[model samples]
Every structure is written in C-alpha cells, then in structure tokens.
Target: MTLLALELLIMAAPDCKGNSVRGACGYGEFGRDINDGEVSGVSSRLWKNGAGCGACYQVRCKIPPHCNEEGVYVVATDYGEGDGTDFIFSPKAYGRMARPGPEFQLYSFGVVDVEYQRVPCRYGGYNLVYKIHEKSYNPHYLAVLILYVGGVNDILAVEFWQEDCKGVETHEKSVWSGS
Candidate 1:
C-alpha cells in the first residue's frame, strides 16, 4: 500500500472576484472561473517569478461540519490584499471549499483555517498540460506561471495555443477560516 501525501496548515479568506482582470502574474486573462486550481490572488508582494503566479495547492477546511477528506487544488492566478491570509480563493473556489451547506453558508464563510499543500498538477489526466490564455500562440515559448510548479514543464505551461481552453482536475472541495 502507498501512503498519501501530507498537507500543510494555512489560513485563507474568501474573495468574490475570481477572474476579474489580467492577473498581476503577467499570465492568463480574465473570464476564467475560480473553481479548481484557481486562486483570486495572493498579494503582488508575494508574487514571485512563478511561485505565486500559478502555484498549485490543495486546501481543505480544518473545522468540523465543513471538514472533508479530499480537497481541491487552487492555482494562484492574481494578487490580493496583503495580510496574514496566504491565498484568497474566488467565490467559486470558496463555495467548493467552505462547509457543506447552503449557498449562503458557503458564501458566508468569509474566512477559515485550512490544511493546504503544494501538489503535483495533473491536467487532462496528463502530467504535462498547456493553457492557451492569449491569442498569441507559441509552443517554444512558455509563460512564467510554469515556474510556480518548481520550473516543471509537466504541470501548467501558460501559453497561447490558438483556441485551446483548458483547466485542471478537481474534487470540487474548497478553505481557510479566521485564525
């Protein structure tokens, strides 16, 4: 038998905006839903070359009644309020991560404590996947978002592939509460 990965504990907040504008990360465009593998932002200050831009993470609710076995992978898309909160998930992400309840209860979860971990990304069941965020198509050239996965070309390659709309796999569970 194989042992599963161990997750780290972190704090998160709910951000209504998911894909508002072109992220400060210098990659990806707006109109993308903040469902799985999508983070509203993490504060531009935290925005590094490729770390905060498209870093993949699995965040789970730490509190009961909202606790879940499997969590969702949220990708860092843009930047948000610079505070103790590490990542601010979009409403879609929040709805999935928050306690299992009505839409209001899910949305009501302004903030919460969650267990998170950096995980290897799986796109379309492929270890390596590419995203066409812009019309400027380029196969040789990749975006900085790939750096967030530790310079791995196997997870997310932010590039324009001429009408290729893509995303990651998710359990739909969504994260953090007050500290």
Candidate 2:
C-alpha cells in the first residue's frame, strides 16, 4: 500500500484576528460539524489575537474508515481578527476536503499537505514513473509513484522535492489515485 495521501481543509471563526497563539495567521473555526452517513462529530476550539489555534483533526473518508485513507482538517481562528475576516482552509487542506472517499490516500506534513493535487509525469524523459501535480501554495511540484505490490490497495508512494529549470523554481508533486 502507498503511504496515505490526504488533502487538508481549514476553517476559522470571525472574531479572532492577527495570528493566534500558534504564531500562524489564518481563519478560525469556532465550531465544526462533520456528517458521515448517520454518524456525526462536532467540536470547538478557541482562537485569539487573529492567530491560529494550532489544532488539527482527522476525518475518515472510507466507508469502513481505513487506517491509511484519511484526511486532516485544520482551522486557524485568529487570521483576520483585527481586520475583517473569517475562517479559511490551507490550499492543500481545501483540496482534500473537496473530495471525501477512499478513492485516494492523503498524508500531511507540517502545515502543508503535499499530496493534495497530483499530476502524472514520465521518468528520465522516457519511462513512466508516476503522475505529477502542482503545489497549491507555490510554483513547486509533487510526484506520486506507483508500486506493484499485490494487495487490495495497490502500493504507492508520494514524494516531494524541489526542481530548478531555467532559473524558474519547479517541484514534482505526486499523489496516489486508487485505480
């Protein structure tokens, strides 16, 4: 099986402002509601000074909730505190939240989820290694390589690295697309 690929979604409350205690500036989620079939989970976190709460939550997408196929959701409540603002999700998280299913895997590292958007590419300009996708934040890229290991969930790997071409910074982005 490939390492989990996840997209991150963020939401913030309106009252917070100017970066919260987490030293990050973004939206805040005073309240959250997740509906899965007939089951639901609700939680609340605090945001102060337009700062981020630094809280992360996981939401399962699989019908039975697979251990590997899940997404991480984050909310920065203090983003637009002093200024007029509301909740916002990181580009990486937003992309993941948009799709809820076991069709793909998602993994998160630090504040960024590199596996959010994946595009395919060729290896050594000849062999087909995997797909490549652009990072939501910067012009960089990510790559998702496929492994033929015999299993219900075919093995796949996601890798992130920086690439420089003609003075332009480009990276390879990849994610597992359960095919």
Candidate 3:
C-alpha cells in the first residue's frame, strides 16, 4: 500500500547528491551507489524504525510540464525528519523524475509537490544480503543490516535462536528495538 497518497512537498538535499553519505539507517558507504545512486531518505512515518530501510517507492513530482509521468523508483536507504516533507531525494533521483529539458527548472523550484507509493524492489536475481555491522565483535555482540529486501513487508523485528541443553526450547530477543 502507498504510505502517503496525498501530495506533499519534497526536496532534494544538496549534500546528499554524491556518495550516499551515511544516514540514520547506518548503511554506510554501501548505500552510496545502490540503485545507481537513485536513493532517498524517508520521513519517520515511513522509516518505521529502520524497517523501511530497504523499502522501495515510486515517487513523482506533480509539477506539470516540468515533471515526467514515469517518475523515479527509489530505495529507502536512509532516514531523516524533513520539514513538512516525506522524502529528500538524491540529485540523481530527483532529476530522473523531471522531463527532459525542464530538469533545471525543476531543480530551481527546490521543493516540489510529490506523491509516492510503496513498491517492490527489483534487484534482478540477487537475493537479500545481510551485512554484519563493522562494530560487531563476534561473541561479544552481533549487529546485522539486511540489504536488498525485495518485498514491501516491514521487518519489524529480528530474532536469533540457539539450541541448548534446555530441550530444544526457543530463546527469543529483539535485536533492535523500535522504541
């Protein structure tokens, strides 16, 4: 389902143009080139406490003549609270949503009215990847970030289980807490 059906003002972050600088999602350098640098930072409502990290969305500006109908398909690689905005797209993603000759015009507007919807991510034949956080030091602690999660489902929580002398009982704990 579309997270926000109503049109809202969204802008492109000047600093987020190149090398997907780390954001709240902690994807680090790897997020830089994801989807060919066509990525976006979503608001808290859509961020869903990191569950929206790898979610994909189809976003298009509503500006006539300056906007293209196809819109850009972007992955939520980061999170940030915008000023009355739902997304802050990278330069590439923002320009991709504009018509051929009016890209500069669209950029001049800075903030444009937009509508976005949650969509399935496409990564060809690649499966979901789990990247162990660099800070993890094995038995001491483990932190994993899921990448390329293709579906629209939210990863509300992650659980780790172990088989012990407790007669195959399950031990459950939340790896990351939303609260």
Candidate 4:
C-alpha cells in the first residue's frame, strides 16, 4: 500500500504472450495472461527471491500529456534489472500507460519516472488456484504454483501436511518434526 516513486522501462518480453513459460519466477502459463497480459518484470529490490511473483501494482507515468492518470495495473511475473529502473513493463502494459494517442512519443522515452504502489489483484470470478508444476513427482518432489492470489501479503512459504508425519501441538499450533 505504500506508494513509491520509481523509474520504469519498456521491454518486449514473452511474459505478455499467452503461452510463454520463460520467466525467472517460473509462473508457467499463469504468467502468460495474468492481469490480461499486463505483466511486468521487477527489479531485484522487489523480486524478493521469487516472492514478488503474482504481486500486483498500479503504475502511472509522470508525463502529464502523454500518460494517463490511471496508468496501468500489472502483475509481477518475472525478474528484470536495469540501470535505474525498478520495473520493466511488457509492451502491452507500457502502451496502456499512454493517454489516447502519443504512444510512440511515450515509447521514445524508453524509461520514464512513475509512481507505483502495491495493489490487490482482483480476478473476477476466479478463485485461488494451485497448479502443480510439470516437474513435480508424487510423494517425492512437489512444486506448486499458486495463482489468483489477491491480497497485499507476499507469499513467504508453503507447508504440506501429511497424516503420517508426527507433529507437536504447541499453543494450538502444529509444528512438524522436521520442518
């Protein structure tokens, strides 16, 4: 919820494409079309070691004439680093920041000063979904990607509970043995 000033750049990445699974966060198909192809790659400060994935932000460029007041809403789906830019928006999302015309003029800037803040992702009619990665093997390796999370809290960790695993109940909280 903290609004911060940052610099953003435009990039032509496949993250906005509907079938590309190539990203640092490994979001797979979810990264493709989340937020209606309005996705961005954040710098290391926001990346938080893949925790930034699926996070949403409302970004507005500072250009009074070329940029709109609402700017664009985008989901962080990948990791990108630039000279001083904190965000690298896909072409689709970057173009949305333009007002009516002058899209080319805005793009000519390449990098622009922008104000951004963490925003809740609202996917209408979509509930939270977890997609098992293709590399996951039952009872051996598990890699699950959570999608459609619409809160401000960053996902820190995931716990898998098994009935066979013994756990200790402390203060009504279950603490698994080896966790």
Candidate 5:
C-alpha cells in the first residue's frame, strides 16, 4: 500500500540521529543546525532513488493550527526508515506541523497526515562552495573544503588559478574534500 499523506510519526531535527546528514545518498555532514525547510526519507526504495541526494519536495500540513498555510519547501537532506511511514523534520518544522502547544506535548498526536508533492526546486549557485579558512595563508600552497551546497556528490576536483600576480598569472592545484 502506498501512503498519500505521511503515515508515521515524525521527530524534531535536534532529537533525530545525527540530524540525518549522511542522508539517503550518504554524503556530507548535514548537521541539525539546518533551516526549518528540510525533509527526510521514506521507504528504502524511495531513498535510493527519487529522494536521494538533491531531490526537492513540498510538504504541507494542516494538522497543527499553527502550521503554515503555504507549504514548506524541503530538500532531501537525510534518510528515515525504509519500511515505515517516515518524514523526520527539524524541531522548528515539526512544531509548525503540529498543534500550537509545548514541545513535550506535540508528540501526543503520534502520527500525522498531510498533503505533499514533489515540486521543481532550484538552488541556483555552485553546489560546492570553497571556504578559504582564516589560517590558510601560505605562499607555497593553498587549502579549502569543497562544501556540497547542492547537486550530486560526484565532485572529482577543484581547480584554481590566479589571474595576475606582479604581471604574472599563476594556477595552483585543486583541493579534494574526500578524506
């Protein structure tokens, strides 16, 4: 049987295991400190395919009077159970999805049913962002972390070249974040 509305009970992001980082696609450290508009996995099959790495989904709810009328747009940043109804949300997201009550009392609902759909999502920017650390000041070499902002985790390399240095151009080696 297919589930139309999310079938299982959901957990607040901070309470979840590791914030669902190494998500379904199994990459990056998507810490719980993420925004409220992030969703989790469904069945094993869905996680392996549809909602894997960079898929987007719109999850709307009406159970909680305090929830938003406009849906929350979330990226599949993590994975949940495979054989059960799953939709793990961040603490703020769940609070918005449930009754306007205390955090400890929200779980009283157990499971909730809401409308959801897969919408076209575009995170316009380099899926990978290079963060030049403050301590990365070296004359002979350079270092950085290829943070995955969006898209697939198929990064092979990061190339860099200086435009001009004393009327001379220089290009340094790229740094890979696969440690």
Candidate 6:
C-alpha cells in the first residue's frame, strides 16, 4: 500500500484587511477579502468526504475564533491508497478524490478562494496552488514536505516553525514518515 501525506501553512497579519476575525486575513485584487464563512463551509465538506476510506481521506484547520494574533494557519491532508487505489488531491479545489485503492495519493497546500480554488505560486519548476490573493505578500504558502509511504504499518509525521530573516518571517519544517 502507498500513502501520500501533504502539509500546508497559510500565514496572514492580524491587521490585514478583510475579515480577519473569521479567518479572512487579507484583500484580493478584485477588492474581495478572505471569506471565513465560505472557507469554513468548504473545509467542512472536504473533511466530511475525506474521513471515509471508500472514497478519500481529507482534513483541514481554520483560524481559531479567539485567536487575535496575526500569524499563519496550517492545513494538512493525509491521503493513502491501498495497493491499487487512485487518489487525486486537487490543489485548485483544496480537496481530494480517489478510487478504491492506494495507488494515487497526493498532498499540497494553498490559500483557498471563495470558490475553493488554489491560487498559483511558483516553486521548484512547478506551480504551488493556493486559495488567496497572489499579489500581496500575505505570506500564504503551500509546501509539499513528504510524498511517500512505505507499507500498511507506516506512520507520517509533520512539524513547522517560523524564522525571522532580514525582517522577513518564513516557515520551516521537519517532516518524517515511516512504516
């Protein structure tokens, strides 16, 4: 069996425009801010569908209501396909779909839009899909740490940290997976 795990971190300033209280931390080019209601609804649906193995596995975390601090929200999705399963993690939709096996499993990160789509970001020859406005340095980033799984007895682990460099803050990670 093959399992694919993905972890993503989305950061935003508390003072950022839009509805920060509800997880919408910044504004977009169209003058639209992150819509907390929309993100939560979509995330809930994704988790609901992800919990069942007959289809796919999915999970999401949104900004907490009591969190008044400006920072990043980390969202992680762990997808596993049995020996013949096929799973598709659509970065654009911030969701995943799969057949009844463990052959095709993928993980990704990004800021989701009101429509639950990923905004494009450039990385190592591929586009990092996100759901937030691409223009502003909202610091919303999606990183694919580990994409491999050994056998059925394997476990995946992921961790993150923030670093200050040249007046800029960026996230770092230490990921490990084994059977």
Cα lDDT of all candidates, in order?
0.47, 0.27, 0.68, 0.75, 0.48, 0.24
Number of the candidate with higher lDDT, 3 or 4: 4
- TM-score for candidate 5, residues paired by index: 0.52
Best by lDDT: 4
lDDT (tens digit, per residue) of candidate 2 on 58-101:
44333234223444343322222221222234334333433455
CA lDDT, candidate 4, residue 125? 56
Deviation in Å, model 1, residue 171 alpha carbon: 33
At residue 85, give the lDDT of candidate 6. 19
Superposed Cα RMSD, model 6: 18.0
Off by over 4 Å in 4: 14-19, 125-127, 164-179
lDDT of 4 by residue, 1-179 (tens): 45799899888665434225676667666677777888888998998877777788999999999999898999888888986999998888998999988988998999999999988788775646666656555665555666666667676655666656433221101111122
TM-scores of the models, in the given order? 0.55, 0.21, 0.80, 0.83, 0.52, 0.16
Q: What would the TM-score be for candidate 2 when compared with the true structure?
A: 0.21
**Per-residue alpha-carbon lDDT of candidate 3 for residues 5-95, written as tens digits (9 for 90 to 100):** 4343344455545234446666666676778888887788887766778788998888878999879998877776666678877888888
For candidate 5, the clash count comes to 3
Local distance difference test, candidate 1: 0.47
Q: Kindly indicate the candidate among 2 and 6 with the higher lDDT.
A: 2
lDDT of 2 at 168: 23
Error of 4 at 98 (Å): 0.5
Candidate ranking under TM-score, highest first, comes to 4, 3, 1, 5, 2, 6
